[model samples]
Target: MSTVQLYAWGPALGAPSIDPKCVIIEAYLRLLNIEYTVVQTNDPQASPTGELPLIKDGNVWVAGVDRILTHFSMRNQDANASLTPEQRAVYLAYNAMIQENLYDCMLYTWYADMTNFVKSIRPTYAKLLSFPGRYLVPVQLKNSAKARLAKYNVEITSDDTTLPQNEKEEMKELQRTGWHHMYKLARETYASLDAQLGSQKYMFGDSPTTLDCIVFGYLALHLYPDLPHGRLRHILTHEYPRLAEFCERFNAAYFSREHDVSTPAEDVPSLWKVLVNNPRGFFSNVKDDIVSYMGTDAPKEKSTAQIDFERKRIWSIAGGVTCLLAYIIWNGIISVEFDGEQGDFESWDEYDQEEVDEEL
Candidate 1:
């Protein structure tokens, strides 16, 4: 078999990888006993999705952790085979919750928090790039990040200038209160997960599963990085000691190789260089290139099972819409009545005796 090559952000915190998505992919590779070479790149455009942690196997290049995992699992039927149908459902639910909810909180912590961005994340970028790049790239990325947060309506830092001074302070207060609530929610989530884990080695007992890799990626990345806020560190290390140990164990077992805090930027083709050289050609061909290599369109055709699932999904949505429309119509009809002496007025209850008598 041809070597499977993984392109991801390089190691950080003495671990194989630090970017949460990269960590998840690397951990999955380790769990599957797949020997792969890591091609570290800081450039966002290195992957088709403009993300890190793409994998190339033979002629195939897979982007995103989910897609990469699926690619491998399709060949290795035994992958996640131990998980019963119920367990798989639980795994998917938790995965979505973590990816959607917890990920935003993590972003707010690292990017939206000016303290962490300046003291921690900024310096790393400085080391990773050269001259104007060190300054320009970080600022561009930070601004883009803030824009994303604003797009998502996540709480903004006090430093944001989009609002008036008074409103900025209000936003900051809201941000603080929101973080507190988010932290509490995170604690509860971890507590539930810890309870589920119990004294077991993995999330589902002794053997490792894809879910374990997913959990480890997020938990470990948040805990290990030297962010300005010690809240996550304190929670993981003190509040959830077992979870902390789980990360440590996984790290030791899988990423025994020595790795660095930053990768040399030279390895990645500069985004500017690609744009300047190819310009229109680069943009035009990129989608086709990715599709050709991936051997599928943006979304591949669904199997019979998947088709059935989608059909059920469509019906479920239609049913929900139907019920909601019926409810609105019923409420609208029941709430008001016409009268000759009085203009239209509210009838608070459909079963009101007076209204019933008047109707009769």
Candidate 2:
């Protein structure tokens, strides 16, 4: 049998990938005892869905953790194949809850929180890129995360522009409200998961299953990374020791390879070199970002209201991007060129006069 090729984000904090989805897929592969080679990359363009943790088996490419699991299931390599019908139903319910609730908390910690982003998340992901990308990609990711949290009616902003004292106090109050909401939700989730574990080695039984892999993936991120404000970690370690122990045992069994499989450091090229050497690839990434922002390929199973909401989101994002670009260019933070030269008009006055003369 040919070896499978797994393309994932670079490793950090003794994990295969910083992404929980990537870690889940890698753990599943190891649990199945599959032979695979890890390809560390910082670019999501390697996947058809413009996401990480993709696999290439023979000539077939599979993207997304769920899709990869389904791919293996078709080949009779399912981890949960032995699960009874009742257990399968429970697994589905728990999986949805974990992905939606716990995953959002993880996002809030790493991206939504300014302190954690600056202290840990930014630096970890920055090492995977070079030059301008090292500076740009992290911000882009944080914006995407903030957008996701907005769907849950949670808002956080980093608008540091000068304001009146009263306005500044109000802004801080709003941020505190958002933070408290996230903390409450995360605490409830940990308590529920702790009660569910209840002295069991795994979530379901003694042997590990798909649910175990997913749980460990999220738990490892919460426990392992040294974040500035580790509220989630504190809760798990102090209140939910069972879940902490589960993570330790799971990590020892699956991730403890005799030979270190940590990704070797590679020299990433500067943004300029990336654009000059691989212009097509660079534009491909831009196109992917636009498509992701628009979300036009959303699942057809969505309701009419959901589709309409997506349409509205697309228009709003388009307008926001336009205004942001205009602001940046106007302030000389970014420059634009036409015909391989900077535009001749230095100000709107010059542009208006040019238009008037042309009309005359």
Best by TM-score: 2
Stretches of candidate 1 above 4 Å error?
13-15, 130-133, 147-153, 157-177, 258-360
Write model 1 residue lDDT over 1-360, tens digit each, in one string. Answer: 866777786666434565778889888877787867767765556654556677777778777878888899888824589899999998888888776655655666766665566567667766765543454445545545556556456564422122223646644654653666667767887887788788998888888888888888888766888775656778989999998888888778766764323332333434433433444444344343223323333454445643553344345444544564465457563244558766664432333221110000
lDDT of 1: 0.63
Runs in model 2 deviating more than 4 A are 158-177, 258-360
TM-score of 1: 0.66
Query: How would you encode candidate 2's per-residue C-alpha lDDT over 241-345 as one tens digit per residue?
Result: 899899999999998873224342232222333333444454455566556545444344544643553455456556645664576567764356676655653
Return the TM-score for candidate 2, rounded to 2 decimals: 0.70
Backbone clash total for model 2 is 0
